[model samples]
Target: MAAHRARRWSLGGFVLLVSTAVVAAFAFLTTGPSADRADAATTALTWSDEFNGPAGSAPDPGKWTLESGGSGNGNHELQYYRDSRDNAALDGDGNLVITARKNTDTGLRCWYGPCQYTSARLNTARTFTQAYGHFEARVKVPRGQGMWPAFWMLGDDLGTAGWPSSGEIDIMENVGYEPGVVHGTVHGPGYSGGGGIGASYTLPGGAAFADGFHVFAVDWSPEKITWSVDGATYQTRTPADLGGKKWVYDHPFFLILNLAVGGDWPGSPNAGTAFPQTMTIDYVRVSASGGSSGNGGATRTGAVKGIGGMCVDVAGASTADRTPIQLHDCTGVDAQKWTLGGDGTVRALGKCLDVRGASTTDGTPVQLYTCNGTKAQQWAYTSARDLTNIGADKCLDTKGGSSADGTPLQIRTCTGAAHQKWTLA
Candidate 1:
């Protein structure tokens, strides 16, 4: 796929690193509000690694490829990137250290033959690819004036379809100057990037990214791409923006880890810039389970209108009671202001449309008021094609248990119930 061009402000000098603070890493996600067929037990997790043994023979041919060139692919920094062992090394310590050393190779032309430094660009392009799945990586970067390290994934169909056409998701990108701040960006049609191409997320503590490794992840699906660090989700985007350009991301993609030196990103290296800057990759993984498709659990898709019954951007809301509430129109009202969430339970008013305070006794009206902090609001759907409210031990029931609207949705005990259980219907 073609690389997307956007206005990128050299933030290497702008973002100041935090010098004092406690490091607290945590992910905010619900574990067991209820049980579903797709519970942790039924799912499986898969894994893979570069595993170059001890010699570090230039990223495995089965797992990765070296992207070559020094033509300043837009970001106008200086170092020529090479695919040699000196730059990309794998030691017995179980780490892939891609270094950007101030050396130079002369075999090639380009007049100024061997310059000052070379970096490595590697990717898992040929072996296998994936789409709409979970991806995560743990890495530690190097610090200095010109060092720029990125842990990201790109669409493989780029050569045929250009950028802004084939989507790009940047999980973590850090510059030496801005040590503690990390960037999470998305590139596509309208959400086109460049002038500061993406966004920046800073840690409370001024922990230089070059000092320690951090876990970066992406929960991607057919609907959107969410970028998180240590479990804190920071960015998300929908299909409408890129689908118009031909939803290239709907297909599979691979992983890439590169420690670039002097690109258009971090500006040219300064005299103070350190030599042999390195980026260490602990591991890269992809998971096929534990996710949310943004389908509002009901799978009821006709025309998404309001928030609560009110606000405009359900895209920005996230909380227990505050979630996208399928509403009627755009009148300025609290009920209209819907907050969308990663968790499946969809809410509008303060509370969840739970089985009436978790009362399994039949005819529990699905009400929305305020959050009562009880199990009644907990809901779960299973792969067994069933839906249940764990607290009350009941299933969502349709009035007369019919599939018609205004059937007055409620909750009833499960008894091999069909209408009572659902799968996004």
Candidate 2:
């Protein structure tokens, strides 16, 4: 983690409190589409760690690199991370237990003299990285003030891009003081440190997360990322939510797990804080979209309805290159049957939905062309119901927002208007 990572602040009274416009943007960014969990459940398992090692054994070295130091991980945390089974070990019962204890004998020197606590931090930076998919972990967090546990990720380009430019995704983070809530956040340039974009999910009826294991996850794709707790989605973020800032999560990233004591965000553990608190992890898994590996899954075939409940039809059902795509009545014909494919192509009449001339200009006609794995043909049907061209970063729209039959489709700046909203089956 970098110096500006995961250091959130209270918007109400903190020195980092953002302006009113930013606050309003935050509110809008956190709002997500409904039925997100149902959509996420369809992914196929791709990678996982069950922690089935012998009791008291170290985690599989091939899968994890135990980070050791008193650097505090740029959070001004108190704990000295030790790469020892005393701090992290697999219990006989199929769980990885990370224990944070009051330090006494080790005498590890931290930035502020001797360290007061010892814990563990582990990452998969050396073994694995994935671009887009579903990442999840089942965890029972530790309680008491000053305890911070998280399952998160950093972009693989960290060495080159650096910090926020490399991007970060915090799937789940919990501070002991907020026993009933956990947060999911994304850090990028202009939105690092206390300004990271995210939202919190709280358990119902004031239930404490430490009371039982809960599944925390993120369904991520090129266009959007949805965060969930126990299969219930709380937030979904997209490039449109970035307020013109860059979206840096399109590349592969590696995972990390850590427990820190007394950080700047959580403050130093008080007299009431207990030592030797343990965070138990049952499993961590990753799945690919559409029940298949790679960018997405099996092709989904159906009518892609747009404004006025019209289907996106291939003009004249022609397989010829450069055929225009238009809006027409929903007739269930092959011309109206579009295939949302694994390679991010929208296909009908055996051709791909492409931005004409590979242009990024507004009002560029969206035509059907021979499928070529080019950015011009890539599309992401976002949770906001906008069919966005990956190359243009624009939405599919009917010309002049008209609903008349044979109205040609084009790529334009996304405005969340009715004409840009699509319903893909």
Question: Global lDDT of each model?
Answer: 0.55, 0.77
lDDT string for model 1 (1-425, tens) is 11233522122111110111111111112233344322332212233563546856556553566665555545654556677888887876778888888765565322234556778777654433455556888888888877778877656554444455556777888876788888877765555555213457777777777778888888877777787888988777665544455445565555667776665457668888868788988888764443332322212211223112222222222322323322233444333332212233433422234555456687776655333335666555545444466677776555564543223556677766555544321
Leading candidate by lDDT: 2
RMSD of 1: 18.4
**lDDT against true structure, model 1:** 0.55
Cα lDDT tens digits, model 2, 1-425, are: 22234542211212111111010000001112434323533544444688997999998775677777776656778888888999999998999999999888556987688988999988765544566878999999999999899999877666556677878899998988889989899999998888888999999999999999999999898899999999999999999988999999877777788898888777789989887899999999875565333233433457899989998999887766788999999899667876554457676543578899999999999997755558898887767988889999999999999999999999999999999999865
Stretches of candidate 1 off by over 4 Å are 1-43, 50-52, 108-114, 195-198, 239-248, 290-425
Counted clashes in each candidate structure = 33, 0
